[model samples]
Target chain A: MADSPIVGYADALFSVAEAEGNLSAVEDELFGFAQTFQANEELRSTLADASVPVARRLQLIEDLLDGKASATTASLISMVVSAGRANDLPAIVDAFVDRSAGSRNKAVATVRSAIDLTGEQRQRLTEAIKTSTGKEVEVKVVIDPSVLGGAITEIGDDIIDGSVRRRLNQLRESFR
Target chain B: MVASLVSLMSIVAFAGPASASGESVGSCVAEKFEESLHHHGESDHVTSDDIHHVAHDEAVQDELEACLEAPSPILPELTEIIWGGAAFLILLVIMVKKGFPAVKGAMDARSEKIRADLDAAEQAKTDAQTVQSDYEAQLADAKTESARIIEEARVTADQLRTDLSAQAEASIAEMREKAAADVEAQKAQAIADLRAEVSGIALGAAERVVQSSLDADAQARLIDAYIDEVTGSNG
Candidate 1:
């Protein structure tokens, strides 16, 4: 399994959560962390930089998930960082989320927002999407300020675009 | 002369049948003609006595009457007719057997030659007609062959024109296609360069504007409010 590092790491994290009876919490926390890691390229580069000591990278991951996530989630993330797989964190988190959703028979909806959504907003948006699509969805929101004012949602091949970025592109095209 | 006249008169008055009359008749006409000549010789002189004159008048009167209405001096007899008829028949027979046959043969030969000449003329006319018809047919064939050759030349010229036109059209089409492809490639290159430049400027400006407009707290509150509105409306 380790021959394919992306899948191997995802599987190991998935097993740890399942064994600890906290699969859902681990999936949510990993999804948030992967989003943050992608958003801040400086932080991601520093953590994934090979010049930094392996122990320092592990300590950084522990400090990141100290109070925000469950013990199993923290341990699994720390283990991936310790294994020197920080560069593959986003891909590994996606693999893990896909595996978790498939097991639960729910669809993955990746949402790009200007900031993190509140718990109440998350619940309502999920229920609203379920009602509209007639399928249970695990919504993963990423803070992307480039989207300007509105959120953009992608579910498989479908895109629900409500972003100022798209508007601006349309305006640029008209100018051309 | 008087005595001879009396004698000739007596013979003429009493001539016999052809048994002896041919000689007598011949001698009688000759003797009478001679005796009459002798009387004219004697009576040609004017009379000296009245009785002589009267006698001469009577003789002249008698001669005149004899000359006017006297009988034939020599009568035609049977023996003479038979001999004449026989001679005529002999002459006719000679003409019929020899002269007539020769003339008829010459006429037949002439007629046959004429007929042969007419046949030769007819053959000459037929041959002339055949020669004329053959000449006419040959002339007509020459005309038809000339016309066909001209038509073939025209057709070949037209086909050559068509082939040249088609080739020109194909060349023009190829040139137009190449020109269109070049234009399309240039347009695509321009579009790609413009897109790269525009996207970089737009992303930078947009990132700054959005970041300045909303902090994490404001973004979260706005998102929660939007979500709340959407859920409440649906319910």
Candidate 2:
């Protein structure tokens, strides 16, 4: 697998999951790996550097995941890095997520927040989104410090922004 | 003295006639002759024969004297006048022939020389003017050539400067374009990273929603509804 072989690997992974009857679990794990890769700049740079040995990069992935991920998920990540596809980790994960969502008949809704939401808040927000858009959503949230307060969500091409960052930007623009 | 002797001879001839008529012929002859002699002595020796001779010589002597002393009828004074006039006429002819021709020739030669000198001067002046004009023309040509060369140099310098400025501007524009491309690539990489991070959070959030919001039966029903929605929309 090449450095930018995201789609190819994603297709292979999706097929493998379909064959093994564990698409959801693999998709979820891949999604979490993508998040960890994005948030950690040092990990991304290390994995992407061609000078680092393939064995060392694979070991780094194993050590990082340890007991947090399934055997299948760890093996899959290791295989990708060993093949020098570390830079494509996020794209592969996104593809896997999309594939899994498609198989289960659902839309991927990416959401961001300054803090983790309670159970009631998630339920009400999901119901509200479902009622407003008339579509089944698989909601995912990212805790971002840059959000400051409030939440912003995206479903496919649609966006729902209700955040302190956006309010402050508007205020700054008005002052200018 | 000649005239007194002639007068004495005339008296004796007269006295001889008187005495001859009065005496015998012989005695008369002797006495008359003696008397003539005495009278001649008294008259400065005048002889009777000398008186006859005087009377006979008178006409011939007068004729001879006339021939000797008539003042030379062909006048030498007239000959001298004629000779002097002829000499003066010859001198005048010689002077006219020699002096006048020489003077005329000298004047003619002088006038010819003057005319030739003037002609030579005119020719020299014309040659000098020609030479001066030629020099002036060459000078003008040189000035024009210098001006042309200066103009060409100025044009060449301006072209070089323009070319240099254009090259510099082109280089700056190329550098700016490369910088912009690099920036765009970096921006794209950053956005992709942000998107991936947010997707992970969304996954975790979804899991939490599943775990907290619904029991087994509700989950099954929610799953069924999602499946129905997706299939209906896609179909």
- Write down the DockQ of candidate 2: 0.04
Docking tier of model 1: it is incorrect
The CAPRI-style docking tier of model 2 reads: incorrect
Q: Give me the TM-scores of chain B across the candidates.
A: 0.48, 0.46
Q: Give per-residue lDDT, candidate 1, residue B93.
A: 69
Would you give me the overall lDDT of model 2? 0.70
**DockQ, in order, for the candidates?**
0.17, 0.04
Query: Could you give candidate 1's per-residue lDDT for residues B1-235 as a string of tens digits?
Result: 3334544554454444334634444455455444554565566453345334444565654654444453455856566566556545655666677768888999999998999998999899999999999999999999999999999999999999999999999999999999999999989888977886787687667666766877667676666655655455436
Model 1 iRMS (Å) reads 4.5
**What is candidate 1's DockQ?**
0.17
* Residue B130 accuracy (lDDT) in model 2: 96
Best by TM-score: 1
